[model samples]
Target: MAKATIKQVAAEAGVSTATISRVLNSSGYVSREVKQRVMAAVTKLHYQPNAIARSLKQDKSFTIGVVLPDISNPFFMTICRGIEDIVQEQGYHLLFCSSDEKPEKEEQLLHLMVEKRVDAIVLATTGGNEELITRLAASGVCFILVDRRLELELSESGAVVDLVAEDDVYGAYELTKQLILAGHSVIGVINGCMGVSTGQDRFVGYLKAIHEAGLEHDPALLYDGHFTEAGGRAAVRYFLQMAKPPSALLSFNNKMTFGALVELTESGRDIPGDIAIASYGEIEAARLLKHSGIMYVDQKPYDLGIKAGQTVLHRLEKGLDKSLDRDAASPEPEPIRDILQPALKTLPS
Candidate 1:
């Protein structure tokens, strides 16, 4: 039996070799119906689009590329697990890379993935280049934006994108409201930088809750945590040095909370006794903090990742439904946006 070739696959599918090439490359405007026929024929023959046999740049690599920020973070890693659960079963290999929260690093990684001819990309995104992302998605390589998303200006870019993330506003609002309801008027926040969308949403939710309670919004209490543990530690130091430190504190994400907790423990302050603490995400090393009260939201990181994986797979294999065509809307490829709610829990002091 002669090994299957593109020409053979095209003959088997009863379509022109040119059409077969376009479908395998996922290029041009072939109707889904025709695409399916070509794919079926290729599958029946167990065809492999080897670089030696054809134009390597135009063939589907059958690999999914993943780009994330702070790969050390368990939240994102759990999301990766979720994604792997689905994509791996479909016989798609995953190539994971970390952006280290740098947009330039992410850009470099993206180019590398394209150069390698990955079929699709699932990105946590550091923002800073919406047009590039749009073009890549429209260029036949599928892109799914997960975790942090593109800024609003490009949220509706005329490109097909899938987004799965935590509902930042909801998580922040719930945490802030919990502290306010507990009778803490003097509250401080270890917040992510406002330039980031997640950071901005969390801050806005904090403000919304504060305003609803008719409390004066004090700029002095706002500490930019810069989405880092060091930032949280520094915020803790700044707040502690104040003549009147806030009675309660809120850290936007778990990492910063860990930093603040470390600083507070060293300073001999008691949790919920000397001060109350609430945060948007869970803290690590729970055993060490047994004596302290720490309320946190479960960002559902793992489940969020699974959803992202499914969304990307859907776009690649099944494609998007015409009713919600992302390209038809201002955003073009209609984003299959999934926002999971963060569940709140608390430890008694």
Candidate 2:
């Protein structure tokens, strides 16, 4: 059987080849009705574009590299799905890697992505390779920083780095404030690494609420959970051994929340009865465990992923502009920082 071509697809869709190109490449504006028609025709004919030929003509690999801290985390997985959905429409492939929250591992994976010559990268950085990331972006590698931001001044190098992340400080403040409103004086905090941006911002928020509520600064109530299940469990164990155990607990992320829950259950403690709990992020399992009155801030990971994908597409489009004379008086394109607000969810008593 002969392979279907673009010409046939355009003819079947009742549109010009240019229109077909625009739709297939996801480059220009095309009406939803026309897009649907073109897609239907392509599907009916089982049309497949020659990726090698396209790559050669365009000088693009049509591949996007994605690096996240933990692949096992459902939050990251949802983000990946959003990115895949967006890039796939533009005929781009994804090369995914997990850094395991290690800066060394993240650097290695990033180097590998550069070696692979991916057209762009979406990274949830481990927050330790600021220089390397800045250099790569300065070298004209399109990057969309997802869920985390680098502290270095990338704008100085004229590097195009876009950031799409939730308002971590605000979310943490709201979550912690919810516990405070519930009349908890000693609130235990299961925190992630203090070095990371999210961790630092969340800790700031927690402290802000604590101070605003006139709670004393108790160093012993804070436990570093490192954003892991084990860390969460260890924090609970430590809290239990404290001379004055906290009546309420606040976990920084979903993984730590799970860990804390497990520890509490094993210790024969009733959730929200003996000890109240709140989390900075949602636990997917809570939906299954009906009536689990866990107060949490819904970070909307899937939506965040979608926004990141859109940002990547926008950056790639801008990068394709050959008309701009860089050495001329054209001003540098400012880096985009998109901060999304997460909703605080409180269950009814």
Candidate 3:
């Protein structure tokens, strides 16, 4: 049987196709009675709205592109779930891509999504590619940055795209202070990639905490792990080989923390016994490492995701229309920035 079309639904409901569209899109004002009648006809006809047809008519794909660094990371996965909860309900689909922490790859993925004409893109950028970003902004694709924001050309024009992230600097400072209070002055840090703001700010927090405690901040005690498990393991190796190894270690993130654990366990170094360790986020072995004195900050990744989703959808629904921004000089909508404060949680030793 041929599927019921919008025209058929309008005829059945005794209304214009524009009225049916208003009801279907839930946009504009429609009388409650008219809405009910339209829906009744829609149900009676078993008519399904064709997204493709709507896209062609409205010049919108009704799809959101989500590009992040690591797909395997549980934090990002949970964030996606939060975004999905809001976006899916509003008749929007999600197009997901993982950049694997490479700047060029991130740019490639963004370009591909732009080509596909996604209504908006939620990106956790790798802190590179200003040229690409400039082009994307000029093209007028709505964008929201999640977890990390790159130091690109957007801020120069004061073109702040929507961003949702944790307070990494304060969270890191708070975490380090706790370690200091625990009586560890000589602390070693396994830091993540310095390319992104999260990495740079978190390290800054560690420095602030160390200086505040009046502890000797040794240059040799620092290790750049490049935000990888292998980097974490290498940092541990370097720390263990030190003539006077740090009594306490701070892993910048969850993945690095797990790597630190692997090194500690393999080398027969007892946790909080031989050395103490903590991190900014939870590890995969959080359960098994319960008695290991591994601390983490609850960043509420899922909540952050939901907020990011809300920001992008609001921009799409309210700010812009299907008519793309052709003029570069027009004052774009102010970008929204929401930062959730992180709380420290310690796993008992």
Candidate 4:
């Protein structure tokens, strides 16, 4: 038996090969009547498109590309879960990739997604790839910036295709403010690599809180981390070795917290006894602290994902609804930078 071809399907559907091509490639415009005919013909012929050939003709692969900084990060994993939920339900496949927080890697992935002609792309941006995103948008492929704000233009353009993120500055500021109010004068900060948006924002928030409290930044107590256990461990050691160590510490994420805990334990330090600790996110070990129930923000990756999925689906449906034509008044929903508030828990002092 011979393999089915576009020609065969085109003939069966009573449409030109070009019309079938448009429907298949998801490129250009095709009248609904013709699109349906092509689809029917495709079904009738039981045609299976050659992966390479189909990609060439339709310029689309019916898949959503998800790019994250670090897949291992719990926060990102939660976001991935959210993205996967919607992509799977919508019958679209996901092409998940990690940039490892590198700009070059992010650029490479963006190029690949464009080349593969994914239906759309969801990115936790590395900030340096704004031009790449802009160029992709110019090419008419839908892309959303997740986790990080791309730029002022991307946020305001309403051309962003999609957006879902947190109110990082405010959340971080509030978190740090709590530590100050707890009466810790010398506070040590464990910051994630400052290259990313979340890292920078959180750092800013920490500074804002300290400044508001009339505290000056101390170089001896500030340590930048890789947002992992190793980085956390390193920061803990750095702070402890200082002649005048901070009376309390704050970590940027859960992984860092884990490392910080390991170091503190090895050094025979007691939580809130020798020093107090605060972290940005939840970790299992946090409960072992003087107060486990409170402290750290609940970023809510699951909820964020659910909302992001719904947002993308709404956009997709709007695109598919003939009545909601390209010119229709359904303004692309406002870019949602969903900044969730962090909950504070206390350790037994």
User: Best candidate, lDDT-wise?
Assistant: 2
lDDT of 4 at 174: 86
lDDT of 4 by residue, 1-349 (tens): 7888988888888878878767987989998888888888788778887876765655556688888888888888888788778768877778889998889999999999877777778888876877778767655567677777665575344455466777778778988899889788799899987777888888999899999999999877778888878999999999988898898888888889889988988999877778777888777666765543236766778777776776666656554332324676655545445555555655445
What is the Å distance of residue 244 in model 3 from its true position?
A: 1.3
Single out the weakest 10-residue window by summed lDDT for candidate 2: 320-329
Q: Per-prediction TM-score, please? A: 0.79, 0.83, 0.82, 0.78
What value does the lDDT take at residue 179 in candidate 1? 90
Q: Tens digit of lDDT per residue, candidate 2, span 17-77? A: 8898899989999999999999999999999987766776787888999999999999998
Judge candidate 1 at residue 186 and give its lDDT.
93
Off by over 4 Å in 1: 1-58, 152-157, 320-333
For 1-349, candidate 1 gives per-residue lDDT tens digits of 7779888898888889889878876777788888888989988999887653453653666688899887888888888899999888987778999988788898999999898777789998877867788878666668888878776444444466777888899888888998998899999988886666788899988999999999888999999988788988999999999999999999998788888888888899888789888988787674467667778887788888789888978887765433444454332445687888788888756
Q: Which ten residues in a row have the lowest lDDT in candidate 3?
A: 319-328
Clashing pairs in 1: 156-331, 159-333, 160-333, 326-332, 326-333, 326-334, 327-332, 327-333
Candidate 3 lDDT tens digits, 1-349 = 9999999999999999999999988899999999999999999999999877778788889899999898888889899999999998988889998999899999899989988778899988887876777667655668788999766656555444677999899999999999999988889998888989889999999999988888767889899988878889999999989899999899898888888889889998888899988898987586686478777787798998899889978998785432555466666566687989999998877
Deviation of model 4 at 314, angstroms: 2.5
- List pairs with backbone clashes in candidate 2: none
Clashes of each: 8, 0, 0, 10
* Candidate 4: regions farther than 4 A off: 1-60, 154-161, 288-294, 320-337, 347-349
